[model samples]
Target: MLRLYESSGRKISARIALGWEPSEVFECNLLEEDRCPVSIQGNEINAAFGAYEIKSYYLRK
Candidate 1:
């Protein structure tokens, strides 16, 4: 599963195993570094492509 941490170490973000795995990390996404989980935040997970921000209040999928 992918562990999304905030820029600062003061807080942790999310654990995503969102039922999708690719061949490589660089070919997938910046946030998509490891294996995705089978259970994310359902519909509350938000993702930004280029920017490093996941979210201030919610964990991403």
Candidate 2:
């Protein structure tokens, strides 16, 4: 899991992509302090891997 924060103090939304897949996915929940909301976009980081491609996405803030 990754933690994101709004250091610029700006309220914004974005789609974050990762290059690997995890057991669990993010759903952009704002329950913790100093932590931004993010969601898992996908697990297709590269096309080199046949079907085991690992990737993720999350909202920055």
Candidate 3:
């Protein structure tokens, strides 16, 4: 299983989906580090995780 969350955490998006419900989100463990690969706009940190493939749309403030 995998966990997914919006920028602010809401019901609009799925906080936790299947390991690869849409075949996009997946849980990966590197050595002793676990990553979910969450995509955040304008953030380069996520780029390294391939989060750039997924786009999070801000519906409201």
- Considering every candidate listed, which one attains the maximal TM-score? 2
RMSD of each: 10.2, 12.7, 14.4
lDDT top scorer? 2
Model 2, C-alpha of 32: deviation from truth (Å): 8.2
Candidate 1, which ten residues in sequence have the lowest lDDT sum? 20-29
Model 3, 1-61: lDDT tens digits are: 3222344433343332222224233344423245445443332113222332333322111
lDDT of each: 0.37, 0.38, 0.31
For model 3, what is the alpha-carbon lDDT of residue 16?
Answer: 29
Off by over 4 Å in 2: 27-39, 44-61
lDDT of 3 at 45: 18
Evaluated at residue 12, the lDDT of candidate 3 is 43
TM-score of 1: 0.22
Q: Model 2: per-residue lDDT, tens digit, 12-60?
A: 4444456665434433334433443333345422111123223222433
